[model samples]
Target: MAGLPVALAAAGALAYGTAFGLFGEDARTTAGAAAPAWAEEAADGFASVDALGQKGTYGGRGGPVVTVRTLADLEKYATAPGPHVIVVAGAIPVNPVGKEIKVASDKTIIGSGTSGHIVGGGFFLGPGVHNVIIRNLTIRDTYQGVWNDKDHDFDAVQMDGAHHVWIDHNDLRHMADGLIDSRKDTSYVTVSWNRLGNNNKTFGIGWTENTTADLTIHHNWFRETEQRNPSTDNAAHAHLYNNYLQDDPGTAVTSAYGNYARGRTAMVLENSYFQGLTNPVIKDATASLVQRGNVFSGTRGRNESGGTGFDPRRFYPYTLDAAADVPAIVTAGAGPRSALGTPRAAATRTLTVAKDGSGQFTSVQKAVDAVPAGNSSRVVIQVKPGTYREAVKVPSNKPHVTLQGMGASRKDTVLVEGRASGTPRPDGSGTYGTGGSATLAVEADDFQARNLTVANDFDEARNQHLTGHQAVALRTAADRVLLDALIISGDQDTLLLDTAAKDRPGRVRLTNSYVIGNVDFVFGRATAVIDRSVLTLKKRWDGTSAGYVTAPSTPAGRKGFLITRSTVNGDVTAGSFFLGRPWHAGGDATLDPQTTVRDSVLSAAVRPAPWTDMGGFSWKDDRFAEYRNTGPGAGPAGADRPHLTDAQAADQEIADWLGDWTPAAG
Candidate 1:
């Protein structure tokens, strides 16, 4: 009874303390930390209106009007003391990075109109600056649309991070890197309501490293961009809601590192649309993200030798909308992902090839060589079902070339094969290395090879010296390359799904086809979907056969490889084929890249220890994933091989690696 009085007194003191703390309100937490020296004393000088219509530039303080005439005058007033607000009217600025407008702390730059542009370059932010708002402007022709390279970064405009920022209502285009990046810092930022485009290079958002957290990217339009780079894999725990992403014909949109073994990142993508071009979408991870309702239009290209790996959950949202120009589905919220509401002309304009000697030659490759590049009109060479012995090379200049073979993917096969290393060309003064000792070499972007079989028939022993003896089948190094019902065959580097170089990782789709090879043959860096294809390995007499089938040489910062809904078979002895080996030039297996296989069939010929170690290195560093594969080759859980859980398989973080784009099982 005596202790009750003490308890009541203590409770009363605690309540009084809590009330005082709540009423006092820490200024730093409520109004943000101290402003940088470069920032003016107050934020009330410029013209600004609050949500409730209260007007002030320096937070309603009666400050001087920070008058600026030209882009340079704005820069001068930005650094001064008396004027708080910085009214940037007239034309876009010139050299914003070098001048006075260096984005001081605690400031806002509200553009005059959607046409209020940033002409010279993007506004670069230094490290540690906080509390900034940049909105309602047209940003173009900068190194990056909005460049923020510092480590401790946050962003508002949907670009990369700079921390403590608000970026909304802008049209940003023609940049070298990502439109927005937030790979660094635990920045709570909101990037909403913007239009993002690529002037020439890769990515709409470049989320890198492991630091970014609590980011919301919503209601953004990513239209008419080119070549989404593989380095944009750093977006962890990101919310991508109601966005529209589309590219023109021949461009590639790929989401790299979704299945990264370092650990699956969390990405939430809902109510979005992706459409058009060669590779509408590509993913390379087994990430942990949520992609509830996304529509990916257009058929993903077939990999060299045929088939694609577009996952069912991620890629299934893409319905066959015959009315849509790009064969993709339209989602809620955003405008359609593409300018044209439907698929390419190939959807409607079917190619039928018959010759009463009307064309130059009966073969498809010959017709491609006859046509010139930059031809606005398309040339559809309808191919009849016969074994044509020749190599095909479609260069970058030769655009809009479509080769339609006679038959459905499974039934029809127009075969093309070559034998010698230096085969004589039609002009025939010398020989060209079209197939590099094998068959067809397709190097054309925006090129479609439908219902065809491209093969290589080089007898290994015939080429006495193994020095210049690398064989090839169909080497596709083009962006937006589609291989529908295509069959490719050879030994050793057979279907070289290779890029032109390391810099250019193309997007390819291999659907409803077959590829048969031995050794480290099926390999390269192309973001390919080997969906519903049969990969067979013929018997090899040579004891020198490595027996490794697919060697993915995906670079450190690139989307590695994906083999989904396909079959792997071999005629050789069981446990003869090593599923894959790391493709490092120095034979170092430690720098392992990411590779995944899901819902496919395998043969007993595949080794139980699926991954092969090279040059005294462990395979643990390598990134590899397999889900629900059935066959004798897919053995029980062991050291070298691990099974993917149903939850891991369903994670949208990894689904983004497949663009979470799935096509219907026809």
Candidate 2:
């Protein structure tokens, strides 16, 4: 909640006085015009609550929004660090067929329109992984040609010891195991608006004996699915509402039971319709179950109810549609919709770059070259996964240009160049110098790059004889720029945050990303906020342990670099790195540079005296400070080290650094 999400969330929290009102329209989970209405919506029901040391279900809400087509890309983003809104846009036939992709935390794997499909594979959420949303996709065909296959434990979506997840609007069927398996005491989950069919084990609630799982399942159509229409076992509170369960005649599959509560589970089933199903509702002797306003037609067997179950309204407010309108409503809106996850304007404003020549252009620069010089609208350059061995530059005139990597992980796509400050130009125009050594130079306003790795591999060890070693991975020379979910790696001066001199304005937001370097990696004069990202302190190429994370050269009172809710760690020598130092930039004493690292975790690699003097400019005179920093490297404030007061730190918030410019997903 560092950047635009905080403001968007407040506006969304009043939609309908219920859970629908909890999120704003701008708190979008999808991108493009083809995005479904619900795909843009946030989590509902139990998954929307903040409990069990986890935030509410905001799948990649504050991170980048990307579209994935291949299994490798899906797994990469699913397992990558930080939050990502992954839109599956094509039929990705699993390579190994039944392999279950282990998904990490803070992710949204959604389908693009009706075309997105996960064939013969599924997703798995392991222990401690939270804040996930899987919606509007077709996950099926892992049947192994066996109706009761016990060999393969394949499931469309499975979670073990995971919490705060929402599985909605999916069509899951024909899997080797349960389509949706919430096992090992997974808590705070909501299963809604999905269509589960053609499976033996449709859904299973528990594998653990502890009654700690909390769930809310609603607005789903369970058709021709056998048992465990989500059999709740050892669950603390299970609320099922407005669901349609039916088994018509001549169907190959038959319903065993609609909803079963067992092993000390407490369930409250309400406003559900069941047709031609046997044992629609059942409760074990050790479980507590209550059924209210349920419709069971042409169904025989145990329709039992007993003790009072836990109240769901005590958790989160929800409004349920009438039971009679469930089949009609779910029948039309259960699976993927037409508008969800599809490209609204793919024919325009998008350029494709691939090394394999599958895209419109073989090189990224060729695609950038295609844009008109004075282009005003935002144009996205979708670069496929490959090592682009070239430098890229976005001129200042080409504003609102986004270089997006078509990979699940940032490491999958690389824009690399081995250029250093001393690298000679082919035209014999002398050395490239510090400003020209950048691999990816963004000199345009409203520039953005995501799911990409921009690196300057200058080979310092092999090129030690070279005069200058300043290699910059990324450099921004414009304003309103966003580098989300990216990895910029180098040794010295890795990321230069700059402006068009002192008179011009520039602001960069680097969120949920990694900036790896040794000395002055994040040096610049621009007003930048590195929020919720990692600053990896790698050893210099010369094997030197000493380094500086930042070197800011801000003007008198304007904000410089503000690092918040980030981590500073690496496999470097302890007490060898300083947090930052003021940079007078050519010994200009008029510059009152400032850098503040607050609410972050610093490793022992950081020196106790984090701020040090440089070029006869004492850091004490500048604004090199830290506030409420933790970890082994953090130290007390002293004459050499500066710390911001609570009052002063409040003014340095991310909102303070970025005023009305809310950078969001394209």
Candidate 3:
């Protein structure tokens, strides 16, 4: 057994002796089992002066404390409201201790510090408790902490299925489910300023799920807590803000999905910090989202494939300056390399190499500058691999900008690397403020890149002082973009898939390709599908485990990322990856949800608890799903892993996203 605290041990013994003096051996033995010797003694000393029915007992009198020593005694006394404050200050036994004790409405529970703890094996709540507050306690090693089996109950605290409750300044660690939980229609709840760590080996809850509930999670530290299959129903409303999160080597923090129904809707997120781990966030949402002013500086150290991806434009809503001197746009035609080869049957148009002195430019951007807007057919840019070192952009008006390479052999074709500053021009001399270092920026609708490799080979490790230095390989905010046989590599948001259309849904297809990055490097809100592709996860030498493969910020009511028939391989562990999570609190649950990994292979580096929070919002109401994935990370399909039906896979409209191109395979 682990060592017990000295104070609790001494107090328990004294309390047992007092029981012997007051109610004979039966009470003494019960007291002995309830707490440590020291805790019993303290209880005895306090009990001598304390009475069961004192005038100030129920109110906040001189700690007119209601002390229940044993689990049995606690159970007996917890039925009615005898005191304003209840203290469970002992080492409860390891056996089945019945269920949770639902505190009376407006009651408070005071316990030991996070270090000072009690063991609640399986205690549950009674129905219809409201306005309860639980603080400064540690409940651990239990089946469910404060479970509410009843429906429509509100204003309770300290355990599973708590609704309209306030839980603050407590520590819940090493539980099989969630640290705090709620249930059906449970609403108007607030959970703040708590230390929630390592619990729930299974898919359970501490404070969770109110199908029609409204919850607020703020200023709490969720460290090393494991979460799975939180909620898929769109009716749950959640708000998360300004909290500290640390989970480096455990399961993810949150999970969301719409159950059979449309699922929970409405969510908001704001300023927070996450660190000390791999897979910091996720979003499986289908609702529109509004994300603002949050920094994901550290806490993303897994090279696992399906981890972190989202749109940077939505990260800090106020920081978007599109008119800034971003990278030069690449749109015109070059040599025979510019000729794009359509499938044997779908040849809509043939390429005409630009022989005019001014029409032919060395870099891809020069070509883009020459093209006219709104071309009907796709403009193919057949690139020959000698490293076209320049930043390129395809404007929204240009529409089609296809960079076709020699082939997939890697030796014949390569779209070398480069980036544009928020202020700098395409050449090395210019200075672009915020949006620089982007090798390729696509803002045009229906943009496609085949047989090309884009990279940002900037020396970030050279003390460049590039804090928000996004040396991106691609920043795409277009509708219907197709990347076939493409390769992207960089650090800190390498491939920004920004699909943030409020009304219409955009589409993206990444096929037979490879992408590598660090940090929230591959993040965005693109309704994308990565079919038969390879995600290569790279390691950072800084000893910081803070790089995820993907982070999707898919808001409510829009199409999100869909990854299928892919391979996730890297040097990281399975436990380091996050599948997806909600991006905003109280978000539209039926909006675009992040989905991936059907019929795929995820490396062992992907963590089992693959879902976590978006900003501060828990993803219990999002639509994140994975199906029939094989690898060391593969497990039986459960809440976290839902096998997609063949019909559902076909309906996702993946073919249209790949426009005018067919993958080598069926």
Candidate 4:
């Protein structure tokens, strides 16, 4: 209980023994009939809390039990009247004619064991369908569908205008669109203890112009899903608690009204765990949220609300979970699988790359190209001790990839390339842009690099006569990316976080890393956090009197960059380096750049009057601030540097910056 809120801690302890205390007193119901042994266990596991679908009431209460083994058999019983219990056994493959299976009212579909599977089709709950229970099965390889012409809508389970539905303990993945979706007046739904992965869109709640969705999403494991871990549009009331989200590209919970009539969306998010995600909660100007006891570690994103405000207690009367206990609790019991079981061996495929003929591959690019297209599981590429000269790219289709280097230090295994903004392509096209000039470019989600050095060896003195001197060492456009114990070195524009064309902005986390450059080396528009790292500014080669450190082009209403508990050291002359400047792309007046540097040491290499102008844009007009910084280069009072007050610092915490997602590192 390290960071637990006192009120939530007391409540969790009080509800430890009583079964009905967990769900609140309003959810009690009478036991109607005797249930099967397996069904009883499922009820006991989920009934700790009481809600609309508690005690399996959504399923058949008094009807006879019907066991199903084939797709045709299941389809035959789906339309039967009266409360019925339908148990599924063995594999059921759906037809390929774009047919959807429709379910009726008062039905229960339970898988007999772990061997139950539903392939190539999905379940639909719409119109008069009500009181349904689906549990203990695997739904995979559903037809890929489209939504709004641009968004993916492939779904393993879709509910529309339904009530009292409970979907629990199922593994869903590999769909063309979303894994689960509930929209258009769907109410009283509980989704728990399920595993969702390997899909573009994971979950979606509230669609079109309707705003009457009452949902509870708890104890679910979302792994490696790209976006919309449920995009909530004008949802009336949504309670998301105690869920585990890992390696998500976009926002974990999106509450916004895009191109729709403005309405209110009230949300309560508590005791959730986020690891390697971009933003946990992104709300529009019309949305309202109340967050409490949430832990975010090693995550980056904005959690603050930009719209209205409301008290969450008015919507529901429930006990909160302690934030400090969320990681252990979620890790132990969140997914359909239990963490208490025996540890399994690593399932990821490992390949070795050596410059000599000792390994399977000689070049790093060749190893990256060898990855199977649209692979689901993680593939680890281990590079032996050698310097490889190449430009590597991990495409968007190839996700869940890791690049590990066998080196004592980051300097031991290196990837070197030379390409600046002025460098032209082999064809007679324009030169490589700032992003295209990176030595190592990553476009896939869930990408990780450990113990490596990526360098752009552009000759600054020789390229002084060139038009654009920006040479990037790393350009990452994907979300949920991590860089650990790495060295990024170049002269200008060394590291670039490019999300300019993405639907949602990407996020990055850098821990124990070193970045060296002279002008705008660490820059971009993505939401990034640098912890226990170093930013060094080298001397300028053009014989200029001063240089700039950062040039952020952050969009309005978004967090751009944060450097906490780090050190800024440089080899330049005293008072020669400015902290940062602003970049206005296409002279967009709506863009507002933001950056913060707190609790760090600034060397004398930093100028006293930091933050200069760039592209005819004044740095003072942007959002830049410093807090609790000390050293020789700390700018004086009344300088251009704005100081953050204690109250403002409290509001600008890293936890609030990340919302419900807790980062792994501070």
Clash-forming residue pairs, model 2: 12-23, 12-24, 15-21, 34-339, 35-339, 35-340, 35-341, 36-340, 77-408
- Model 1 has an lDDT value of 0.51
lDDT of each: 0.51, 0.82, 0.48, 0.68
| Angstrom error at residue 86, model 3 | 73
* lDDT tens per residue, model 1, 411-525: 2444546454455546776654534554667677656666665667766665555344456777878765666666666676778777777678666667666777787667777
- The per-prediction tally of clashing pairs is 69, 9, 144, 14
Task: Report the C-alpha lDDT of model 2 over 421-505, residue by residue, as the tens digit.
Answer: 9999889989999999998999999888888878888888888888999999899999988888787888899999999888677
Residue range 1-666, candidate 3, lDDT tens digits: 011112222221211000000101221223213322222111101111222222111122222235444566555444555434444443343344324554554344544222123454433443445444455455555443333223322211234333335555565655544455554444445555566665433222223343454555555665554442122234344444555555554344431111111233444444555555344444444532334444454455321112122332232222221211111110111000101111111233323222233324556776777667887555766554455656687788887667666443432344545432333454766565333456788888767776566777665555355444566778788776767666677766677777535455556767667777655555667777777776765655364443566667775655566677777766554466665555542354444446555778887766676666666555555666667688987777667556566435433434323322222210
- RMSD of model 1, in Å? 23.5
Cα lDDT of model 2 overall? 0.82
Candidate 1, poorest ten consecutive residues by summed lDDT: 15-24
If scored against the real structure, what TM-score would every candidate get? 0.46, 0.52, 0.43, 0.50
Error of 1 at 71 (Å): 31
List runs of model 2 lying over 4 Å from the truth. Answer: 1-348
The superposed Cα distance between candidate 3 and the true structure at residue 623, in angstroms, equals 2.0
User: For all the candidates, what are their Cα RMSDs to the real structure?
Assistant: 23.5, 19.9, 29.3, 18.6
Q: Per lDDT, what order, best first?
A: 2, 4, 1, 3
lDDT of 4 by residue, 1-666 (tens): 111112222221211110000000111222343444444332322222345544433476456666666677778777777766666554566786234578888877765444345766778889657778777656776534432224435468888887778788788877766788887877767788788876666788777576766677777777767677767777776777777777733644332211111246777666877766666666767777767666776676665544343454554455556766665665555433211111122368988899986988999889999999898767888998888888898898887677887876666688888888998877969898787889999999767787787888877677767778898999988876767777788888989976736347677777677787888888888778776777877766665646777888888888888888777876568888888888776787677877788888999988877788888898889988888888998865565778887546644544334321222210
- lDDT accuracy of residue 223 in candidate 4: 77
Rank by TM-score, descending? 2, 4, 1, 3
